[model samples]
Target: MRLLEGVLIVVHIFWLLSFLFRFNAKVKISTNLVAFILMMIHFEAEGHRWQMGLTYVLFIFLTLLILKPFIQRNSKKVKLDSENKKKVKKFCGILFILIYSISSFALVIMMPVFQLPKPTGPFEVGMTSRHLIDESRSQNTISKQEAREIMIQIWYPAEVTDDNQKIQYEAFPYEEWSGTMEFIFSFPRFFFNYLKYNESNSIKDITVSDQESKYPILVFSHGFGSTRMQSYSQMEELASHGYFVVSVDHTNDAGYTKFPDGREVMNRADAYSYSFNIEDEKDVKTRSRDVSFVVDQLTKINKQDSQKLFTGKMDIDRIGVFGHSYGGSTAAQVLLDDPRFLSGINIDGPLHEPVASSRLKKPFMFILDDDYLFLTDEEIKYTNVTPEEFREYHNKITELADFHYEEGIKNDTYRLTFIAGDHYTFTDFPYLSPLLSLDINVDQFHQVMNQYILAFFNQYVKGEKTDPILLKEKKVDEFYYFETNIKN
Candidate 1:
């Protein structure tokens, strides 16, 4: 609960106690004053919806309590003829207080203040976001702009602070981020209001830790209609572990992209209107280009004379790329098209025709959800997939997996499937809300994901020996299946 909300609740409790016990005039007045002050504070602070509503009701009740003493003093008192009548009045008052107490306590408990799990890495994390415009490329007509624009958030290892007053974990302060999500997903705005309080384990623009001369770069792309901050937990974790992670928000494709100049770009309506029928091959190509352009910009930033941001801090030669859903396909395409990225990971994203058909020479990993696990025709029915659609979907996944396996025979490759994992599991959606994900241990899922991703990058990018966890042949409880083509 917020500070003001907590104060308001305490004041309400005091008022309830005073009313039931028939406290002295001075005590009643004190309670009323405190309640009114707390309510005013809550109003100014803009408490949660339930908190605000309850506070208003409590304010009215307290006002009536304060006026009761005045009314009693002015009006003639009526003596009850029978003792039973007085007892009945007292019983009713107690019953009402009981009911109110229970209801108010329930409301307070329901006002949830969700928090992100603390990152387990040794280093603290710092973040900064930048808007990059590719001058060489023209913006798509749907964007109504001149240059291709992308918003990116970068997370890196930071100096840990001992000051308790220092505000770590910077996040969206208001309803803007949640409002954009509600707009894209067509959900009630209040459903995501808690997101405004959601904070990552990363401070804003802290000085980079000097433990390492340079850190390996990891580029992340979000799923269709998702913002770069969608997978914030993962990015923060990676950064805490000494990786410089950059997450890109593809303008006009993401749900919302707010630039430094106060301009906001939303996903194009036409794009979603024809999404189902249109193959996302072009979209994949566009995102691939975006990633390539970002890589080029980072390279230039590393070599720039005046720019302090990431100057000489990026090990461009040890860069890796990864993404979720459509963005995952973009990662694979980037790896295939550009030789800059040493390796790539695709999280539950179907490979486009170009990527599936072509052979990849670099190390790669494919993390899949239960949906992509091999299924028989009879088993396919349980997946809620129509026969025709299942055929095409199954074939595409199989072909891509086969190609990856074949390449794995010559180069390092890994395929992992989580039986309980869903498409949204690859991102922070599962951790954000239980209703948005499948029935699975979200924390465990994240732990396994982070471990595997770090292991892959360690072995490929940093030339570290493979971790023992990655070498286990026996099926672990978290995974449905795990396969690797790397020769021992």
Candidate 2:
């Protein structure tokens, strides 16, 4: 909880305890009113969240207590003179406060309104979005006029000076982004209404940096049923280091996307995107086309930008692509199908079909989540599956992973196994809510991860000197496996 919110909660508890201890009427009334005032201050200053619902209710009860004296001013009141009655009153009041406090504290801890970490780079970050429609490809048959629509957002290094404030303030939408994530995770919609308090690091529609002639480009695709900005931290980090990054929201495939015109699009992909079969491959193939379309549009923008903000600024020849989960597979697909992508990275994603079987010619980094990489016999024993079914499912998944590791490692691939890290760790989600995010220290992990990412792209896409972090296995946080395609 924030400072004022925390203070209000503590004050409320004290107010309850004061009544139980037979404090004077003025003392009790004053404390209760103080709590009520603090709550108002918290609502206006720190912002009220649903987590404070119980706190609000508790304060209302105190308000009723304060009004009870006035309501019963004419009625005869009998005091509880017995010691047993006084003890019972104290016990119940303490118990009630304890339960309410614990419940409210848990909610605040689980879903906090946090801020994105600052990018550890020299330049500031600027962002902008574009709504794209592919006229040739029809998306929905129910709507006769609708076509394949995509939302593309870009982040780039920017200049912030006295004359030019390349930092345009953009309001964070509590319903839109939070609702999208809740839909993906099956959480109740509007449960995270407090997300509006979360601060974004990128400023919108800002001027691009001109410190260099042209900025190398990095294109991004999100995980299945995930929004493109779900991984905004990495985008900002890259942009702050002088890289122009564009993220594509595969409309109808993303969890949710709202265009400038107020049209809302939600995921139309199969619920089981990780089926590890031909279905998964077909999904990857379809989403890869969106990335391709985005790339084509960027090329056009570089030549003639309608916005008149960034014209001929993209270094098209030095382009790279990276993604997480299913989008990771899309990156591999781009490395194979699109020659414009000089390099790529895959974060904890399983590759499917021809892409899995094909050798990647470009330099690529494969970051794997090793949380379940190894399991003991007892750990393997299932809670809800027959041993045979478990073995088959486990074997097939392992075979899928082995294919990517063996085939991908045959080329110039840098494979890093994140120890105890999970799929969401590769993105900005890890820093959003500590309880739902990764177990790792998010800022530290991202600091190291961003360094390696910058080094890999710099070396392959820009033909720059390689950073030593990529030279061999080293430990800055925890021990994890690291290797290259070439044998030492």
Candidate 3:
């Protein structure tokens, strides 16, 4: 809880106790005064949100009760018979305590505290978001605009400082962003109210760490209909380990994107229409272009004098691209199309038609969820399909997976599947809410994921091969399957 919130809770508890115990008039008035002051402070801090409605009502009632002592002093002095009066006071006190305790507990649960996992790497992370427009390409079916636009947030190693304040995880206003997500997912807005207070470990636009002369660049693309902030845990972890990570929000496709000029782009009907209508191949191809454009812009930033944050610090020659879901397919497409990216990681996303058939020569990794690799026969069958059609569909998907595996064997590639993983496991959604995740332990899943991602990048990009975790054979309890084509 925030400072004022804690104060308000404490003061309310004290006021309730004073009322129950029949404290002296001075003590009751003093407690009420302190609670009222704290209530006003909390209002100033938290604003007039419905979450604080109970606090407001409680304050008003307490104020009236405290003032009643003075107004009814002469008339309220009626003394009852000792035995009945004592019993009545005892029962009322117990009831009041029970009611107050439950109410307080409920209120706290409504606005629960949530936290991001701390980065285990040695260096601290700093981040900045930039708005980039690709004038060379026209807008897709989502927007009728002339140029394709994207918002890219970059996280890099930063010098740790005591004075630096941590940044908020979402790029847009917390309430607005949370509301947008609720609208898109059709959940109640209050379901995500706790997200507003979840702050990132990253500081905004701090000085890049000079521990190394240059850092490898890794670009991240989010799943379809997801914002760049969705994979913040992974990005921050990578950035802390001396990689300059860039996450792109494809405008109109992201859940909600806010540009510097206050222009808000939402994932509306146009965006979903294209996603649902277009072929996965075309969708990923367009997204790949966005990644390539981002690489080009980053190259310019590395070369140009005007780019302040990363001019001489970025190792343009050593670049990697990785993504989740549709974005994972985008990463593979980027590897196929752009020679600038040295490696790629595709997390739980199926390979599209042409890309599935093509061979990739660069070092690559495919982190699959168990369901992606082991779909049941019943799951593969369409509701209206004949036996032959079901067979064809199953064969087609299996062939794509087989081709991807064959390509992995031909090049330096790694394949890993988590036994308890599902599609959402590859992203941070599993860590955010248990209701949205598989039945597996989210913390363990995240730990294993971060370990391997860091190891892969460290070995391939930074040429550090000291990660022992990646060299071990797959343990059945930890992974459903694991394979690597690269020879040690």
Candidate 4:
């Protein structure tokens, strides 16, 4: 809840109480006046959310409370028996208060602008975004533009200066992508205007920390129909621990991506499609090329950044790659195709051909919602297919997944399976609303997630001692399953 919003709600409830308990007329009048002022200020400055709609309406009725005396003085009193009138008025008052109290509390709770937990590391986090176009690769998918375009958002360790407090976080992280992302918002974009009050832990575009001469670079790939901002919590956490993390938004596959020149790209496949499609082979290949292209661009940016943002601050040789869902497939392929990436992790993404059958020499890991075979009920609803079709789709995917899972574990690979999680569990979507993944164990999910994610990268990318981190384990009533391979 907002500051003035909570204050106004309390004052109004108190005003109502004062009237009910027959408190002093001065107390009633003063409370109403204070609440009125707060309502006006909150509406104008904090902006109104529909969650507090009734709160506002009841506040405006304060005038009616104050004018009751004048209204009676002006000769408009109901000529009724004293007992009957008192009972009627009391019933009406109680009913209205019940409706107001219940609805207001429920609505506000439904749309809280939750604060992201602070980064657990010593350094503060800073982030900046860049737009890159791969001229070498022609547009493989349907598009008006010729070259493949990519948007990279980088989060890095920042000097803990007064500016960290001075600078404010951007309320809507995906302001540029929101318009083209109508699928995420069933109503108009204004429905999310309340996000203006949302706060982020990482400050925007601050000076890089000089504590480390060159920070190890970690490349990120978001799931299909998701932008680079999806895993912001994980990125900020890694950045705070002195890692430079860059997340890529694959133009055609992202929910939406807007370039500085006003060009926008939307998802080529059905953004709402939850079921797996065989066509992912093309996507897996194309997005894998995207990883290599981004790596190439980073190499140049490290040598001579276009804007001097990362001039010599990148420990380019120590680069690692990781991705979610489809991007996870991309990450696996990139680790195989490009020797530049020392290690990689794929979060909740099924594997495809070639990589599914091929061997992995480098250290790798896979984090999944389950065995990665069957789709949940939500996915079935989103897919909306006949029984036969669903069976066929499930069969094909699981077959490939079985091979992919086996091949991944044959070498130095790790796996974490959240028995009760869904695809969004691997991302920060749960923080927006638990409704996104109803069955997810959010607290436990994050506990195991961050612990191992950091442990994996720290050990592999920076050569930090992670203590067989990839293969450490214990199970509690089958909540989650962890596996690691010790390849001495």
Candidate 5:
């Protein structure tokens, strides 16, 4: 048996002793609280809580049934054999304790056997993924505005096991605006503490196999108020298909981030509010420059790493950028500013505010939400702009960009039209939330999404036409819808 299971069994015994002693309410509450924490830690498998809750209910029922006869016999205050009463009490205690301990132990043991299945697919392996942070900039003396240095994570295919190097957890602070994420406004600070214990903190290094093959560079930008880890499914999918994908976290823009030293940086929503017009433009440009800087750093890693793990593996010339929401706008902006980025993909972002003024000379595609029209229609119609400004901004790139709409297909992507599902589906929250099951079979969605994303990069970056699955316009999976316009 595992050490955790043994400890849980011992805890059960202590709880039984407390019940027999008629422990104070506070003591009983504390013991139950400990049990709750233990159960959550070992809940490696999903749906375990309901199973455990059911067992607890049954145990309480049986305990009451067994104790009723004893209580009745003792109520008469009549003489009874002390030995017989002691035996009866002991038997009840042992029986309840045994049942509780056995149930908990068996659940822990059987978790691995009943683990959820992974997605079904074919993928190659030459990917490397890693998170990079400039810790020096996170110091308190630095104003959040002045803190241009950021935490960026790049996922790529790699073949080296530098075991001595440590892996880091998906460390984001939930304290500042956790309350805002859900409509129920509460203290964001308290949510930080709650989130820590709930999340799995396992840190595994960027693991990839066979480092010899060359792969193209792909830069990724996550949505607003989200950390770089939010799109991990897409990152891993691309890495597994033998491409180097780099993801960046715009500091202060993400919900919150906790460094290795336990220093927590919360979202500076106040700062965003103060200078919305100027700062938003400034920040997006900064993010684009950060992507360029990351590419430069990867070049350095190729030459300097003692293990020579990165040598000849980075295809510096063949780079691409893709992002969602605010990130999607950033992707387009980066492609416009940096000629090094060969192709670009944007997943459902408003073009009017961020990229309306920018013109693109390179190829770019848009994987738009059917709801993009709802998002932009009002602003585009009402916002005042000079004719020259509108023409120079909106009309410059009208012919250069392509749109692919995910609408009206008999699949999960079509069902995504139900507002809450659309924005969250592309994010890691889909996998994290219990509500995911209510919306769609998440595993199926992940499988189809991964396939198409990889196929797009493969065709554009590597000049290879692979995965004909994306060529179809009709629904093949209930998890997605398909539409595309190839720009002339």
Candidate 6:
């Protein structure tokens, strides 16, 4: 248990004692002591000024109550003052009730709200993913390749009605996983307790009649060591607007993950225990194959499930892939290796894979970090990659790609450099805690990335009209830069 929870429990015990022993003459002194203790715990737990003010008021009242009898003891002892005793009992009873109720209420109310913000639109997303689907089938294969298990979350547009079909934000099975994440992120264990309240409609396996519509299917993979729902703000927003989005959580690589069955997978703590090396790239290739497995399953599921929303809505030809961090790198590799993917967008991942050196004919764009892109000619002169290696890496995409910087203006074309965006800024960490957002300015950074990503996918995948915001040179806040892929 966290220190906060322990303090809260102590406060509750003291308040209970106060309620039970309020009438005892000696108990009045102890009641005041407990009130002081409660006040101290409440002050530390809440840090809110109003809570402090209430604590001060309660302390004063308890102090007066403790003193009232002592100050009148001599005068009252000389006579059997029944009326005075009754009056004192009634006063103490009200005082104890008031202080105890306020303290209890504050404990319940002042605690933080912990939830990854749901998308601000109408969508019910349900996802179930399996990591390393091939491994389960490859029981006889003795290949020592590190295959990743994955958790997948699917988001879809739900029919809004009077009926409640809400999906849960965090499932019961994920409770222990949350505890593990608390340790990983250096947060208090109880920090995720409030996630219990994040209730939403579940994604029903009902069928849709949009067989003739041919909606574009979008596949999303989060960065390595991140949950599938890590980008909820962006994924939910996309689904709410009509696209079917599936987010895959790479097993062992995610902070926490649960397979479709009863199995759960967590991050490999030892994977990064020592010095980071090129073997990391091989692990990435393993993750890339997982993406292909998800796509393969979805393609088949879309064809077979005649009684589900995803039955025939997928326009396989209109499919696209996008991801952040290592996931971005995976998308790039998958697009290159798999012909099933038509278009791909990579956000802030370098092309360091050996296979990445091979040319990709696919129409893809890279939204790279500013620092990585603005490497000066002089810097390159000192580096191993000649202008030719850089050219081969950046100049091979078919539809052209944009290398965005944090300082560039938003452009109408698909490519633009964006500034102030950190690697983790494009995830759900911003909406979870203001402290986290301040630590990295995740809110402004992710909002900008999500907006542009949506616009980009909408234009190319759904054939929607390009928004003019894409062409404008603008800064949403102090922390973002934009850049685009260019044709060499």
Candidate 1: pairs in clash: none
lDDT of 2 by residue, 408-488 (tens): 445566877778556777777765577745457877767767777898898888889877767886543474667665422
- After TM-score superposition, the amount by which residue 87's alpha carbon in candidate 1 deviates from its true location, in angstroms, is 11
**Model 1 residue 425 CA deviation in Å:** 2.9
Clashes of 1: 0
Give the winner by lDDT.
2
The C-alpha lDDT values of all candidates are 0.75, 0.76, 0.73, 0.75, 0.55, 0.57
Candidate 4 local lDDT, 1-488, one digit each (tens): 66777777778777777776679989988888888788889878887777787777787777687878977897767676698878887787777777777677666766666676678888888888888888887775563548777888889998756644666665647453344346455446566556556667776777788888999989999887788888777898889898999998887777778788886665656655643555546777788788788878888988998777777888988989999988888898888788989888988776766676677778787787765646556656666576567777767766665555556445566767788877777777676665765776665677678778888888889999775656556454457878765664
- Model 5 vs. true fold: TM: 0.61
Relative to the true structure, candidate 6 reaches a TM of 0.63
How do the candidates rank by TM-score, highest first?
Answer: 2, 4, 1, 3, 6, 5
How high is the lDDT of residue 231 in model 6? Answer: 67
Ranking by lDDT: 2, 4, 1, 3, 6, 5
Question: Whose lDDT is higher: candidate 2's or candidate 3's?
Answer: 2
TM-score of each: 0.81, 0.90, 0.80, 0.87, 0.61, 0.63
Local accuracy of candidate 6 as per-residue lDDT tens digits, 1-488: 22443454445445445644655766667666766676576556533333234445555765776687778877745655598886897687767666766674554445433444456544454433333355543211124554434556666665534367443343422344354455356566455655444333334443332324656778887765667766666776777666778887766666666655766555655322311222246657766777788777778767875435566766777778888767777777787678877667877665544434445555565665544333456745654566676555444321123322211213223444555545556665544445444545554565566677777777767778866665555543455544443332
lDDT score of residue 381 within candidate 1: 56
**Candidate 1 lDDT by residue in tens digits, 188-259:** 767767556545678888877889998999999887887888788889889988999999988777777778
Itemize residue pairs with steric clashes in candidate 2.
none
Give all candidate RMSDs, comma-separated.
4.8, 3.4, 5.1, 3.3, 10.4, 10.5
Q: Which candidate's TM-score is highest?
A: 2
- Give the CA lDDT, 0 to 100, for residue 480 in model 5: 47
Q: Give the poorly placed runs of model 3, Cα more than 4 Å off.
A: 1-27, 37-50, 69-107, 140-144, 160-180, 187-196, 270-279, 373-399, 406-409, 430-443, 478-483
Where's the lowest-lDDT run of ten residues in candidate 1? 270-279
Residue runs of model 6 more than 4 Å from their true location after superposition: 1-111, 114-132, 135-149, 161-183, 186-191, 199-212, 271-280, 306-309, 368-418, 439-444, 472-477, 485-488
